[model samples]
Target: MYSFSTRSSFIATPHESMAELWSAISAALPVTEAEFPLDFSEKVEPSVVDVLKRCRQQLYTRSGRWRQNAQIILDLSWEKLNTGTWRDVDKEWRCLYSYGCLFKVAALCCDDASPATVQEAIRTCDLGLLMGAAIMDNILQTIVRILQNEIGKRHSNEEDPSDGVSAKKMKVDCVSVPVVKQALAVPRIHCPSLESFKKDYLDPQKSVILEGIIDHWPAFKNHPWSIEYLQTVAGCRTVPVEVGSRYTDEEWSQTLLTVNEFIDRYIVVKDASSLGYLAQHQLFDQVPELKDDICIPDYCCLGEGDEDDITINAWFGPGGTVSPLHQDPQQNFLAQVVGRKYIRLYSPEDTEKLYPHQLQLLHNTSQVEVESPDVVRFPEFVKAPYLECVLQPGEVLFIPVKHWHYVRSLELSFSVSFWWS
Candidate 1:
């Protein structure tokens, strides 16, 4: 039963409206003190219910000031409701439901419930149950669709005008290969069974180049992941791309760019002086459709945990991009997608010889430049034994945990790395 006070056109005061709403809520969903103690007085401070009621009143009385006041109240309510013991789960849930009801009422009163706003409410209020229920109303549903469409138009208008396609032509200096002692070759295999993979390489903590594995992937066949294809799929998506040759250089820095712009200026147009690399990014999360193109290797099953535990990351860049020698925490399977990469691996025992960075930020990374080493400053680097290989397209490389490795792209490349414990 929806009833308003007869005293005035406006709803009741904060306390009176909260009591009334609480009463209505209780009537709708009755609960006993035995199951969940109604002791909001002891646990919750500043009273989330009071703030919500005030928010509702603001929405009903002053529509212009509602967004600001409601945001404040929502923030306060979230701060109060987010923390509690698991033993008080029932009590917390009841409070959450009431809080969600207040959000619905406020949204309805304001008549400005955008999809983004509703989505936020779902995340912030009772994990979406109440907001989902409220949006079942035709008016709210229509409002959400209209707001979403408007938002899409606004985003389209705000897109970058220059897609880096017409950028001035630049020179790309030829990459120079460093001279080093001949290292053991990484064994290459083609479509080995899971049992063979585990027995031959995985258990031994040895790196191997896997061939003919990802030949049938969508990224390989249907979507070539070419500059045009990537620009079409993820052009609007903003991503962090490295703007210099290596992070260790004084001129090196990170910048945000759309996929199209990155492809245009870095990969296609070519900036010979400073290379751009999209490294160590979880691209699948930003463009979920890309995940459909690739599949996790079967050998990952030999690890300790479930498939969900694996951390998938993308490494995309021009031919000259380089990743300075660094070690990762978890075992890695790096799959070459578009082009080739030259990799050098050194055992964990060579940590002293590698000269790890002293600073916390670059602690996992080696200070020595593997391509052009300063033997005077780092004399021990000469003794470090390593394994070298050129990873071809549609091949995967298994790197054991804590193995110091350096990667340099031999051509315009895109690679996916799967990290698992």
Candidate 2:
């Protein structure tokens, strides 16, 4: 079952901030504690301490091996099922089954890919799902116990709020407000509009950015490059590039050059799609080491709240292309693989200090002439606690959402990264 879908047309406007949209949506569906219901039982509840302890014991000790083994079995089953038809089996399976393949593969890979891998993998999948269910059950039991304790407290407090309250009361009884679990039977936050995430994540019409490889193997084909007088941070030098003509349309289409052609032209944007069509049987295992410095982890489909997650983005020099200060929407692990990048970080509290726009269309804020930052436009920016990090090959940085940042590459560089919420 091959899966394919054409992308919708939606150009991202960096200038538009989520502030107004969030405010409007929230106003339309005002959440109130009064609307949040709680269901407490009359009987005293069991202590959560014991239940949590049990959950931890089961999760950490009893269930680990079974779950791991189950994952291994599933992987083998999948490989055997598809081996005949799929050449690039794993990648193609990914396109066809999406996360469904992940659940089975991870189960099989939980253990070594053994000979009886397929059957073992299916068995493991069942065990893993069962283990997961058991863990969830324990969690729910704990929640119910806590709720019961709260209800008992409320019953004992008929006379006076202060008189019935005791310091030794169960932690759950400390709740003066209602919980969603009590009222709705389920506790969850659903952001349905998050489905349209990719629509807003980037310039929709813009080509999906990738970390492309051009010259690989026969290493002599590409010249070794370095920049002198590079600013060093943590024993690495930063190469800054200043490419004018803000994000050209030509670059998005990859119309001007192929990645290999771009490499010869002294530029590269990572994407196999724009490169010459690769045959089903073709495999270039010997690509010039693009990231001799950094290591990128595998990718994952981050859940709901992070639907608008940014994947990987990279651009080679024609220096001085300033990426305006903006925070990635989810937790990000950024690595500087080939060249150096100067990064400035602002804490969440510093959003105001940086004078981030309230509109979603604005790409963070207009470039601050950092050398002589215009205090008039961003008066609050003066108070922002700015930290500088120069990423070189091999170093990775974890950046949380709402943490404002800006990056500038010093020279022609290549990099790879992974992100998940």
Give the candidate number with the greatest lDDT: 1
Error of 2 at 74 (Å): 39
lDDT of 2 by residue, 1-421 (tens): 1121222111122233222222221222113322212222322123422332232232223244444443333354355445665444433222212222223333233233332443233333222222122221222222222222333344455535453113122111111121213321211122213233235332131111122222231211343322211111000111122224232223422232222233322332343123211111001111113233223332224333343353544344433344567765655656554556666666676566666656665656544554357898867667666566555554555555556767665544444444456
**Clash statistics: count for each candidate:** 0, 43
Residue-level error in angstroms, candidate 1, position 253: 3.1
- Against the true structure, candidate 1 has what lDDT? 0.65
The superposed Cα distance between candidate 1 and the true structure at residue 359, in angstroms, equals 2.3
TM-score of each: 0.64, 0.34
Model 2 ranges off by over 4 Å: 1-256, 264-310, 363-367
**Global local distance difference test of model 2:** 0.35
